[model samples]
Target: MQRGFFVSGVASTMAENRLDNITHNLANVNSTGYKASRSSFKTVLADSHLAGNQKQTSSASYLSMGSQYIDTSAGSIRQTGNALDFAIVADGYFQVQQANGNIALTRAGNFSRDGEGNLITQSGFPVLDDGGSPITLPDGEVSGTNDGMIYVNNQPVVQLGLVTLINKNDIQQAAGTLITTPESNTESAVGTVVVEHGALESSNVNAVLAMTEMVATLRAYESTMKVVEQYNQLASQLNSDVGKIQG
Candidate 1:
């Protein structure tokens, strides 16, 4: 196979991955507290044995690994006029008790009360209180202060728990939520987690930007395919000419 064909093919594949990321972002533009993900690419040198020229003037196209990580950039806070809808006032996440008792970080604050009167995320994960316990409000609606204080029926009950990740990079995007395991120096709940009532955070994805990127990536992929086709045609023509002369 011609080296150019292989290089062009790789380029086309990278563009395809980029397009997928853009498309997914556009689809989730309206999702509340959604974070836009950006795809990253890395280049790996071709094996020495596959080197066409010792001078290394020729290079294989850069290989792209699927999105390195989702950008957890903060989204804008929008007023929802609902008391249960809360937004973090600062750089923190609402501590939710996940299924297996693991802690998960999420920006989704569309909270509601369950049968047990526990404040929970839309997915039913119980919201953590200051003492690393679930915040439950039985009598009436629960409200919180900017300093992580929670009150039920106008009576102070438990404070909200705000968790911090020791190594933010260790966290991975799982089903659009940030999942992390316990790490060193990582405290379960700190006193600094603030909750804002009656507001919801908007997705950080820029619809216009994501749409533009999607189109650009598709065009780039088409161009790469064109290059591969042209290279293959030239090779075929050269082989046919040589055969005619030899005959």
Candidate 2:
């Protein structure tokens, strides 16, 4: 009976975690270049000693291992007709130089030129070029090719620095849409990814799916609470009966 209550309590915790992840994903359904997260659970087992010093193996409980944000899938591409807007059509990421001079990766291609003619992301992070340097463009009609070549005044200036990670799970989310990974995990993706100029990528979250998941998780949590409450009532009644007998 005690083990049943323990199982329900652990289940309730996992349900709460799942609900949180679903809510977060729903909130970012409209964010640019956003990826949805998923909560994972695992079952734990332990050995119990029964009568006569006999060992029995039984299912212990469930454990919540937290969530993982998936970034491999590409979001839907939308054309904004903006000269600086860009989108990746393949498995790759745009390189950006953070304020502290650390390199970060992102899928957001909504870019603009700063006062110094340096290309930057929406958050003002300088966009890197093929040579791992900030791209400084000349003032003119700006255009980017599918091959990531930046052209100004119909003249080729520099190529965009696009890369792919050996293991995407090693990457962690930074501020906004930026992602950071160890320098050793990155490699130059020269010809693997195709860039679409004059376009942007929408968030990969699905609202209907997230909402359904949230509802289910809430229901499961409520059920667990009921189990815990019933266990408490039974425990109280047994204690009262034992006291009356002793008296």
Candidate 3:
């Protein structure tokens, strides 16, 4: 009888966590270069038979293992027609120097030059070059090629620094559209990533799908609550019946 209530409690907790994740995804549905996250679960069997020599008997339970973001999927690319706007055509990331001097990776190519003529992201982070140094562009008509080659006044200036992660799990959100991974797990993506100037990458989140998930999760949570309530009533009745028999 108690095992039934335990299962219902676990279910309720899991549903709450799932709802939080869905809500977060919906909020970032329109964010540029945003990635959606999902929760993962696992089951643990507490049966005595499975435990062999365990002293206590317990029932099976579900566990919320945690969550991870979907990073490999590419979002839709749209033409912005802005000279500084850029988008990656394949698997790669742009390297940028954060305000704290730490390096981070991002798919957002929407860039602009700062007052010092240094190429930077919309958030004012300096864009890096192949040498891991901030790129300083000369004042002129600037253009970028699919190969990440930057040109000023028809003269080739510097190529954008692009890289890839050996393991996506090593990455963590640093700021708006910016992610950072362990430096040891990164490698040069010279040929893997193609850059498109005058374009931007949209968020990968699907609004319709997220809404559907939210509805389903809410229903599941309600169902679990009902189960919990039923178990509580059954427990109360059982206690009352036992007292009557004693009397």
Best lDDT among the predictions, by candidate number: 2
Selected candidate, larger TM-score, 2 vs 3: 2
- Expressed as tens digits, the lDDT of each residue in 1-247 for candidate 1 is 5566777877887887788778877887877777676777777766324356455444444575645566667788888878678887656776778888877777778889888778888778888875667887777766767776767778888766776666655666655544455546356545566667788888888988887877888888888988988998999999999999999
Worst 10 residues of 2 by lDDT: 58-67
Q: How would you encode candidate 2's per-residue C-alpha lDDT over 1-247 as one tens digit per residue?
A: 8677777778888887788878877887887787667766665764455789676756454564555656568889999999999899868889999999999999899999999999999899999997899999989999889989989988999999999889978877788788899989989886778999999999888788788888888988999999999999999999999999999
Which whole-number lDDT from 0 to 100 does residue 15 have in model 1?
A: 86
Q: TM-score of every model?
A: 0.82, 0.89, 0.86
- All candidates' lDDT scores? 0.73, 0.85, 0.84
- Candidate 3's TM-score: 0.86
The alpha-carbon deviation from the true structure for residue 85 of candidate 3, after best TM-score superposition, in angstroms, is 0.8
Answer with 1 or 3, whichever has the higher lDDT.
Answer: 3
